[model samples]
Target: MEPTPRPLSPHLGIYRWQVQMVTSILHRLTGIALVFGSLMVLAGLFALAMGETSYTAFQHFSASPLGLILLVGWTWSLVFHACNGLRHLLQAAGVGFATVVFIRNSWLVIFVSLVLTILIWAWVIFGGAL
Candidate 1:
């Protein structure tokens, strides 16, 4: 006797996307990006310790377009991870449990993170005095 075919289990396509879900995924992704960013930071420090020549090379790379793009992405990742981490801490304390509140806070985290990233870049570009 032949076996009958079974219906596939629910997957990504089966569910409507939600803010909380997106935030959770982004939190994990940003955590990973931060790890790579930290490695880059370590490399820069190591170059500095080596001497002026090595440090200058690191600085040159950091000033390149690709380096600037990575820096921007790292900045956003840091901001998003920090905001979402605070949200997680609040949830752990039993705050924002209501569905509406949770969704609202998720969007709040995203908005605040973007605003912070933009503000930082603006300051770097336009603010003259340190």
Candidate 2:
């Protein structure tokens, strides 16, 4: 006789998107991005210590389009990770436990992170004191 099939577990395609879920996922991703960004930082510092040629190469790459894109992504990742980390700390302190508050704070984390990233880049590009 043929065996009966078992039910499949729920997956991403089965569930609706929620802010908390997104925040959690982004927190993890930003953590990974921060690691890579840190490596890039170390590489820059090493280049600076090596000599003028190495430092110039590093600077040229950093000013390139692709490098600028990665820099922006890293910046956003840093800001998002910091904001979400603070939110997590608050949750651990027994705050924002209510559903509405949790959801609202999740959105707030996203909003604040984006605003910070924009503000930082604006300062860098425009040379205005923030």
User: TM-score per candidate, in order?
Assistant: 0.87, 0.86
Off by more than 4 A, model 2: 1-10, 128-130
lDDT of 1 by residue, 1-130 (tens): 8777988768867779999989998999999999999999999999999999999999999889999999999999999999999999999999998999999999999999999999999998989777
C-alpha lDDT of candidate 2 relative to the true structure: 0.94
- Please list all clashing residue pairs in model 2, or write none if there are none: none
Q: Show how many residue pairs clash in every candidate, following the order shown.
A: 0, 0
Error of 1 at 75 (Å): 0.3
* Residue pairs that clash (backbone atoms under 3 angstroms), model 1: none
lDDT tens digits by residue: candidate 2, 1-130: 8877988778878779999999999999999999999999999999999999999999999989998999999999999999999999999999998999999999999999999999988988987544
Question: Counting only residues 3 or more apart in sequence or on different chains, how many pairs clash (N, Cα, C under 3 Å) in candidate 1?
Answer: 0
- Which residue window of length 10 is worst by lDDT in model 2? 121-130
- Candidate 1: 10-residue stretch with minimal lDDT: 6-15
Task: Give Cα-based local distance difference scores for all models.
Answer: 0.95, 0.94
